[model samples]
Target: MERGLTNRKEVAKLAGVSEATVSRVLNGIGPMKETTRERVLQAARQLNYELNAVASSFARGRSGNLGVVLPHVPKVHLFSTYYFSELLGGIGEAVHAKGYGLLLLFRDPSEAYDYVSLYRTQRVDACIILGSSAIDTERDAVHRLAEERLPYCVMDQRFDHPQLNIVAADHEQGSYEAVKHLIDKGCRHIGFLNGSPQYSNSGDRLTGYRRALSEAGIPWDEAAVYEGNYSRTSGKKAAALVYRDLERLDGIFVGNDRMAIGLMQGLRELGCRLPEDLKVVAYDNSDAASFTEPPLTTVKVPFYDMGKLAAERLLRVLADKASDPCPQIKEKLPTELVIRKSSGN
Candidate 1:
């Protein structure tokens, strides 16, 4: 029985392998025979040896972990809002399979910038910024990370940062297609339920909505646009406002699914029949969208794919392969417009 700190050398000695071999096996690098790998692992376990993650990472010139920063999580709507969770799930699965760890950091813009500062001082190999608006507001933090030369990727957002990689859904195209679907279904007076106008997504979606209306020869009415926070409560409130002018609106395109669900509920309470009296379309085909009274017609953002893409991009940057044609990539995955009962299609 070995005593004291069980370092890699001691484990290698017990496993009858060189210290370098132990390093390779532990770090998941060079191919050691299965038998040899297993023996080294068992010896480390028996000796209660824990590899120094930081030291190992430094030696390899990489940290086997990725840091993800997201907006503050709402207490009531944890799983209902699938944006962060779906992205995190995809990132977790992908990185775990690749023998890496994921450190999820949830904070508002202020705290998020602080975390980025602390991360720079520490040993994180790379990071992913979640939302475009939040990223833009935290540009100073982003610049700090840039100065440190930490590999980072932006998810679900676009920015003009030269060094930051980005993976996002084509929101403009998706919104255009969604509104177009409603127009094709004989809806003329369509309204838009939008998130903050300050966001890039809101601006792009607004553009899409206008484009669709213009192409359909339907006059765009600015009065029909109702701005709301991205939440079911806000959606419901926005819908009530739209309902006040119900005589002027026959359809709606909501920014996200949760708000869409709230809109539907509001309309129903106001005695408006869905699809029959008013049609609705939304973005982010979250789980709740599918179970709505009349299954929601939505544009499905490929959240899982986006997360995986972000992780892969970050890994490439961390590996100092930014110049690799593969890492310098920006992908705008297409969104699918899932037709359901809500849009009367």
Candidate 2:
């Protein structure tokens, strides 16, 4: 047994095993006999030998890092929003459990960013892209990733390309269920406060709203729809817009809980009674949804679950890259409608 805990040679000598065996056990790379594994582990414990993760990754021709790319919006707190926060939490949990490092990278949607270079530069073994909007630059980047056959997954965005991998919530179904709930309550005049169309989910949600109206044999009123930026301030503004048709507006379906909360507050200030005069249903079912004055009736999109699935799917792609060069995966998790006081149900 060597006195200093410097190299694998010392551990191997103490364990009476080859240095190759020590490397295998330490790096967790190859399958080994249980008794040999225990012997190597025991020797490492005695010598306090710590594996050098960076060196091991290089030796195996890997970066040992999973990259998460988020849109870079200046001065806007990304984590403050429930969508980004929950998605990140899920990705972090999965990456940590996989014993791989997470490397975060931000790309400005206004500018061109190379998504494929992360794998090319050996910065990451695989990547997951979040907050992909309908911006041309962002779309170009995602397309480049797919064209390059990179091992990556895009969360909450659907490119529909056979080469692209996606994990997202069924936002259209969620929106349909919400609006149908309102219609079942005998509300014919419903207003939709929607997020920006730059997000694919926004379009999907709109599709759902229209589908519900069509199914109910109700005419779609373009005048009652307002575009919000999925922010509290925009939601407040949306409430004022809806007020113009206050007499006709019997129910409202908001795109997200953040906007819904703001809209609710603004409507209250405008002297409108909730659920009695105007019922509301929102999406995201965030933590704040339940604590609102009348509680929120919301569509629960599983952002956390989507994130976890994206991360795990990216890992699977990386693991099978050698044999299966290009893997196409598109997974849509189901959403649930949570009924509460806001919906008058």
Candidate 3:
């Protein structure tokens, strides 16, 4: 009935299975049959049997923990961001369902951190890296982890390594659809406010934007493209840079919802009308996008789903290592176009 008092013998007796079966089911080691595994698990639940994590880890040579790495930035709130919060929520759900512990760590971009050390130190059985950039030091760390053949995954980032696991959204297609929607609205001379090139998604969005223009027989104007930092302030700054040619600009495609909202605010202050003067579309379908003055039409990226998939893929990798090696997997999820009043639709 109690933690220390309940033993495997009683569990096996209740489930009508051998003690070894109970051990296998509890430790998640060895192959298991469906009906037998369920019976053992149910008996354990009914008896409130708790396995000794330390003993099991010693036997399995694992920590039974998953590592989640995030970037540490001064003066920045991590959880408040819509993107990271959704991602964490999804990862937490998957980790809980698998009955594994989560170890969250943050490292400064300017400093050095060895990702493979987590596995070597027995702190985590696997790792998931989030919010990756094209920084040289970060790329080096990823390469080191891959070279060591560690079980890990990177969310929303892609590397050229054949063995690296990646889960990301199809940003290029999403961007193309958003731009096409704007073009369908008879909006010509569309301006673009894009994020920094450090992230691959930013580059993909740029490619999609150019492709859409080329398909529609519109000339690409270098002066109409403004680079933003995926922030509201940057969006406001982008508005000023395009203001001199605002008269000729009929629509705009922003990189993210935060920037889209800021661009709206900037346009309002600059004596511009919504949808009537300048139609707008953005990406990331964040919560604030819906509550804007005229709800923004944006690309809805499945961050939560991608996080869950990444965690699931990492768990599979850890399991496969016990028997045979698993091949590297790269999954690209699709996005949806959420039309709202901001795009005049």
Candidate 4:
């Protein structure tokens, strides 16, 4: 056997621990009891073990890799979507420029969120999370990470954790401006089509919609609010409800471009004309938004910038913790309302 390998095995045997434990103790991966760490070190000394440069670096608890945790939805091509593509582009740019490796980790929303395992296993030094919601399991996982003080950031998600570093867009302001724009265009009875209830941004949009109606002196109608899963199919399904209330509604504020596109298509198929019958505004300002029959008046969110900022901030801390040891950054970037023919502008 090679001398280094023999020394490693001997040290593990002398310490009465597995070889994996000896490797972890030497590499500083995960959490280890002080007694176990001491025993491993004493065994290494007895065997006259010497660590190479790479092993020494690992022993210091840094893997020279930045991890990005993504939601693993079956059959969902995340890279093709504008939201995911833009965010990944930004994150990729930051990691590349920083001379650090980018590690992709996928987690099923249905399964347990074990983000700390990546840190403990020495797979990555820091990480960024995407597609998180208000799920209780997610919240508990984040709380555990917070307690550990692991370097990580969550993009475009809001949690109850006070110590979490989050970079998210101002969806409330965006939704408010969308509805307010419709109101300014003489829409007295406007309807709002929102995304899933699981997302925090969904609540923010609803709050904005209500605020706009209250400020405009328009009576809130329970039927005016519609729900969708942020998919074009849901938007198409919502068209039936919108058609039923077509006579009462003069405008609609949609949560996203995909849903808005579907709603418009379904309404058009049912002989409802855009702007002529109902003015509409949407969010996300996706690439297809501009190509709609009547170009969509949508809210443009800074998702790319949000991803970039989150990565840069977290990487900066990893590079120099002494400068900014505890990064409790909470930022909300502004969203812009783009005017187009759909809003009757």
Candidate 5:
């Protein structure tokens, strides 16, 4: 298994698969079993095989562009949103430094699109998916990409498939810290406003919220928990429901800054004072967190770093640079709590 002496046949033999299978596995080809993929990659790493070299010799031509698939939500300017913008900023930087083009793709969740066709047609060298949700269609699409053996990674979302690569923030811990911060501020009756449960992070937040409450000797009350779509408007609309619980709920943990901002506005119009009437803390330390009425306290997720790390590693692997170790596909970064006046700090 000498680095210079290694060949495709040797890799296939060691992996106990065919040479063609090795080629498909290395180049990101399609519709294969997870066991086959694991075997090929493990053999490749073991034999010190040049994955990109074999890919170039056997795979289709490179498109010199990295495709970023984004979920298309109606009337929502994704670029205007701090979450997408920061993540893209990091991806753009990595793609540019590598002298590659960045292709922004939009897909409506209701519709179906073949992600592999982008590779088959030579449109993108690799892919990084954004706004992915916990859906069967999404699972199928990424699974197709893995079956095809193409280099790709998912951001801020989780899938049950073991072969799929993921880069995400420590959301559960972020949620826990936000709730704990409120508890430490002496708020006995804490409320939680979480996003829809379609995404795993929503569930993570709920788990963290419950954990903090349980640890603090507070009973878990379903009446105090509300749900929003992680949108400003949804937050505003939820204010009425949250308002009703004001007598018993003294402090609240919001899912994101946008929702917190909207909730604060709705509360003010409904005759509630800021910080004094209701202490608040939110997730995603977006730019507007500071500009809010009382300056919002929130959790800081390393989105930019998440994007950069995923893109950089995938691109480097695509270049067949054996100097860097084989790809570490799944990663979760830490989150920090930024204390501010909104949390009564």
Candidate 6:
């Protein structure tokens, strides 16, 4: 019995079954009789046969692969960006462990139209989108996936798609808690540095910051709010603008950890003492937060857990374990407040 000598046709001939039946048995597809399946398996073992992934998938009418759409991965330092890397790592681990292949697609809004065209072809068995950036432009692709009954899930953003499943952190509550913590630490004149207001996460985080201040009877000062672009440089520039323009700011809440680090460095250059002259708090508790001159106080989101859960849910849907059509699953994972020197906590 020579290895690689037994192809599907040979196995079928030996087992006295059709090539399709042999294919189904080898690839774990069901509906074949027990005796027929055992006969095919026994033949395979005797022949030392290995299934060709491409051929077997073709026979089964599937690609045996999953598609992952992440918006602009390499454009930014995603690995250094904690939230993106953790989510991607979790997704990669879960998919690889399941013995299926993963196809990563990274594109900006303009280039995302190609994915929409691909969805029309029904190429992949299922898909998982990493962030909302892709969805903002490729909404039609998402709609097409739903129309085709293809399984998919959103990782970190909440879109109002009736069919899509979502796994995300509790950004609203986390931001609220972060702001409240600063307030409890005797920060009265708190400033909010935000990212783009178009994204749902940015809006949710802003709402949380506002809600926390309102609850604590602190007046919402529009002058203290500065908008950035979710970049470290943006944070540095915003800090300069705030320091040079605004006066009497006792605390600052940055939208993300990268921005917070930039702001902190900027403040230090301007002779602003941490937790003494101005307290600082940020979101996304990235690794950079811990390495800042004074370790940052921020909200630590379970990004990896979110990725794992999203992958698992998508697999369940693809495997036909989920019976509900167009199931709307909203999973809200918890976030923790990591205390360090930044907030003087």
In the predicted model 1, the residue pairs found to clash are none
Off by over 4 Å in 3: 1-60, 321-326
lDDT of 4 by residue, 1-345 (tens): 124667678989999999877876775555678899789888887767764522454455666688999899988787777788888888888988976788999998977789989988888888989888888888888888877777888888888877887889999989999999998999998999999998899999999999999998988997899999888889999999999999999999999998999999999999998989999999998889899999999999988888888889887886553543456768899999999999987
Q: TM-score each candidate.
A: 0.80, 0.84, 0.84, 0.83, 0.82, 0.80
Clashes of 2: 0
TM-score: which is higher, 1 or 4? Answer: 4
Listed per model in order, the count of residue pairs whose N, CA or C atoms clash below 3 Å is: 0, 0, 0, 2, 7, 0
Report lDDT (Cα) of residue 2, candidate 6.
24
Q: CA shift at 331, candidate 5, in angstroms? A: 0.5
Worst lDDT window (10 residues) for model 5? Answer: 319-328
Model 2 agreement with the true structure over 138-233: per-residue lDDT tens digits: 777888888877778888887756687888899999999999999999899999999999899999999999999999999999988999999998
lDDT at residue 299 of model 6 (Cα atoms): 92
Better of 3 and 6 by TM-score: 3
Better of 2 and 4 by TM-score: 2
Residue-wise lDDT of candidate 6 within 44-116, one digit each (tens)? 7666676354334335444556778777745677666777788878887888787566777776755544554
Question: What tens-digit string does per-residue lDDT give for candidate 1 at 118-166?
Answer: 4445535577877547445576666555555556776766555675567
Q: What is the Cα-based TM-score of model 4? A: 0.83
Which 10 consecutive residues of model 4 have the lowest summed lDDT? Answer: 51-60
Residues 184-254, candidate 3: write the lDDT tens digits. 99988999999988999999998899999999999999888889988788988887776777888999999
On residues 1-345, what C-alpha lDDT tens digit does candidate 5 reach at each position? 123324888888899999877766666544458798789878887877886564543354566688999989889998888889999999999998976789999998876668988877878878899988888888888877766557889898888776778899999989998999999999889999999898989999999999999999999999898999999999999999999989998899999999999999999999999899999999999999999999999999888989898899788877774533335488999999999999987
Which residue segments of model 4 deviate by more than 4 Å?
1-58, 323-325
Alpha-carbon RMSD to native, per candidate: 7.2, 7.0, 7.1, 7.9, 9.5, 6.8
Prediction 4 global C-alpha lDDT:
0.85
- Clash pairs, candidate 4, are 27-59, 30-120
Taken over the whole model, the C-alpha lDDT of each candidate is 0.76, 0.85, 0.83, 0.85, 0.85, 0.75
